[model samples]
Target: MSKNVDYMVAIPARYASTRLAGKPLADVGGAPMIVRVCQKALESSASEVVACVDHELVAQALEPLSRQDSRLTVCMTSQNPRSGTERIAEMLRIRNIDPQTIVVNVQGDEPLITRDHIDEVAALLASSGAQMSTLCNPISSIDDVFDPNCVKVVMDKDNFALYFSRTPIPYERDNFAQGQQAVTELKFKHYHHIGIYGYRAATILDYLQKEPAAIEVAESLEQLRLLHYGMKIAVATTERPPETGVDTAADLERVNRIFASQGK
Candidate 1:
């Protein structure tokens, strides 16, 4: 792989999740979930993979993986990073990553993250020349459209995000009036935002330095902050249907079941 514009994966292993604390170290099958995330990152075309962790325990959990794969590295960030994006920015600054490189942020909780998706996000950024890039999958079900936790994104004709929301956006007033299950009647396409992201190292640093935008505070989505400030965020679709990320105990159980079946 080429060196400049090389995709560098950074998995933010935030130890404190409101619903599931110590989530990074949580076991899926036999290994820590973050380790599996690192393993996924390793499968990508990324030149390096760094687990940006806050606690020593999370770093310790990733130690074996680091030894096994020379590409794997660990960087400790401030305990109180405002968001995963901030954690990635801190990692770049601390490690002195090249500005021309692209930083791909894969959430530690997503054990099922695939190599294709990570590479696709980086390619989108490189091809589109956008400030950042992320992946989304078409909303196939009514439940996903209405579920607040399932964030919806609206993109322009060029596949750049216009807005992201907890609410069902570009509201299908006529179809929605029928009931929650009426989403199928809508004509417009709805996309479920995948949390994975890619940005040029310098772009992310600039993102972290900006003041929080009002829309971001209102929507509670850090990506909104990027759009609010007129940053171009390119979008790519997942290669296959998206899988559930570990957020709650129930989510972890579901992910474990998939992992077990996959024989991982």
Candidate 2:
């Protein structure tokens, strides 16, 4: 399991959410969502999982969880980061983390992230030796494949991503006219982006310093900035799509339902 390698998972959480303020500390089932996230990361083969949050209220919310389990480490980061990349960069610098160690940034809102998912990503990053790595799951359903909210990724033969977009890519001009079967056959390997990311400590810092790229601003995907700067992102394919994180009130309600059903 590569226990010898030092790896850490840091969830970059913010208190402000345009859809739901104090989103990080929002309760899911019997636990705050962030606590669930931290628990999953700690379950991985990583050395540690920390919450690098901006607000004191968030810290306070996480405090009870930390007391309940001492494995969770709570740290402070700047509220000024323009992007998640910047926040991770700042956390790496503050901790004086080894540049060669692998750091996984599991989105704070994804309470359903599994321990296996975290470990699988870490293994892919180490095996591929790429600057960065992320997960993608094939879309068999026609609705999800065409859904813009399900960000699609086109990868090369080596599994290095060529581009990512909210648009349905590799457009089969004839398929839409033909109906479901035609669309499904055409998109046999269509993949949806999972927000999970792994980076070499140095690569992350380098990405933060580069100016935002043309595609980055247009697509609103920060990972595009790495591609613009000519960074190689290796992909690991998972068996199924992960549960969506809390974004809107509807998303929260959906997640709550899932958690409640599971008796979590």
- On lDDT, the leading prediction is 1
Clashing pairs in 2: none
Q: Provide TM-scores for the models.
A: 0.93, 0.92
Query: What shift in Å separates residue 8 of candidate 1 from its native position after superposition?
Result: 0.2
lDDT for each residue of candidate 1 in 37-156, tens digit (9 for 90 to 100)? 999889988888999999999989888889999999999998878678778888888989899888888988898988888888888888898998998888877787888999999999
What is each predicted model's overall lDDT from 0 to 1?
0.86, 0.83
Q: How many backbone clashes does candidate 2 have?
A: 0
lDDT per residue as tens, model 2, 1-264 = 545456789899877877898888888887788888888787888887889889888888888878876768888998797666677788888999899989988988999898778887787788887888999988777777778788999899999999999877656567776754565465346888898998889998888778889998998888898899888899988886579889988898899999889988
Report the Cα lDDT for candidate 1. Answer: 0.86
Could you tell me how far off, in angstroms, the CA of residue 231 lies in candidate 2 after the best superposition? 1.2
Query: What is the model-wide C-alpha lDDT for candidate 2?
Result: 0.83
Off by over 4 Å in 1: 1-5, 178-184
Worst 10 residues of 2 by lDDT: 179-188
